[model samples]
Target: MRWSIEVFFKEAKSLLGLGKSQARDFASQIASISITVLQYNVLGTVKRFKSYETIGGLFHEATDGAVQLSVTDRIWGILQELVMIIAEAFQIDDERVMDTLINRSETFKHFINLDKLELKQAA
Candidate 1:
């Protein structure tokens, strides 16, 4: 996931023709937001579980069964909006940035689907 995000950032930077420092700054911000969203999703899931067993049981349930699903989705939306804002700030192409964001999001979604499939098979 980290690698995918890094790749997305690099691709976006290259497409935008940003300098190394500016690209690094933008990537850093994106990474920070991603980490925040991940942490929120994890913590939110933990909070939703009444006990360890319930938390463990999450893996056996559907991907969308987690209480943090909606929150994570919202976070992703916010991240995309932020990327658009950054593109505007840098005078880069919004469509290019949006495309990169969408690609990265699709990659993440694929992983989520794979996890759900694995969980279903296990159960």
Candidate 2:
């Protein structure tokens, strides 16, 4: 049982793309790790529902059945998930992410000014 658990970790990190990290910043790394953990949880949950021995088979069973989802719907869902994930990573509870960006670069400051102008116009 313990040996198989070690193999599972090795396979999960290598075969399942868990050990890969391309983030250039600390917050981004934290968020990427968080998202990876979320993905692992989802995969494990899907695996639990199937009797299949392979992870690919579990994915096939999850998506190949009734109620086929459209590509647009999936894209939208992915975008929404990324937004929520990024927001959580940014820890922007009261202030906008744009506010934080104002200190990051001149480009972000310009964008924040433009955004404020737009908000002023809307109000």
Candidate 3:
């Protein structure tokens, strides 16, 4: 269940640039996120039907569906993408790195510091 939601957010951010929008005006930024969510929801509903038709009004078509891949399979897919990104960033072979960062004892301090910084900025 968590994986499904994670995948949704990942797709939303990656495909639609939800939080990555660069609109200068506040209203435009809000509208940017709103449009991203709208696109995500519409595609999610359409994906439920296993048909990728681009016809109009199909966004309101029957939703409540599942992907062809299982949740575990989907998670593995995400992990593979992450691995590729990190490997390329680090100049390492894709197979050579089993990268774990936030959970490591040495990196937890940095994670907490970043979380604190984000919270402070948000507040």
Candidate 4:
């Protein structure tokens, strides 16, 4: 248990930016820590579902621009495009569709980050 805790802290410091905050205010420090923990949790979920055995390995893959998108990445991109295409074809509002998807469920919102998705209509 202690070893696991140490490993987690090590990864948090090195990869997750846990102790890298320069904020001087208490609230800002707390916010920074919270954000770091949230980032760590998201990465942990990715590591669990993906083939990565270490957070470092996952981070490397995510940051390496030379690496080609995996099938899952390609599928996600296609899904985004499909959503836009469907909205255009059906004369539906793209932002409304995204808002619906994002507000529909917490799990969907968490996985897709739909709020951050910028839907650009094809001109």
Which candidate achieves the best lDDT against the true structure? 4
TM-score between candidate 4 and the true structure: 0.49
Model 2 error, position 103 (Å): 45
Better of 2 and 3 by lDDT: 3
Q: Considering summed lDDT, which 10 consecutive residues are worst modelled in model 3?
A: 55-64
Q: For model 4, name the residue pairs that clash.
A: none
Candidates' lDDT values, in order? 0.61, 0.67, 0.71, 0.81
Which residue runs does candidate 3 get wrong by more than 4 Å?
51-123
- Supply candidate 3's per-residue lDDT for 17: 70
Ranking by TM-score: 4, 2, 3, 1
Ranking according to lDDT, highest score first? 4, 3, 2, 1
C-alpha RMSD values across all candidates: 23.7, 16.1, 16.2, 11.0
lDDT of 1 at 54: 38
lDDT of 3 at 48: 69
- Model 1 clashes, total count: 0
Candidate 4 root-mean-square deviation in Å: 11.0
Q: On TM-score, who's better, 3 or 4?
A: 4
Candidate 3, residues 1-113, lDDT tens digits: the string is 99988976777776557699777999999898889778877676666686665323343342324336779679879978998898999998877664354445566568678
Better of 1 and 2 by lDDT: 2
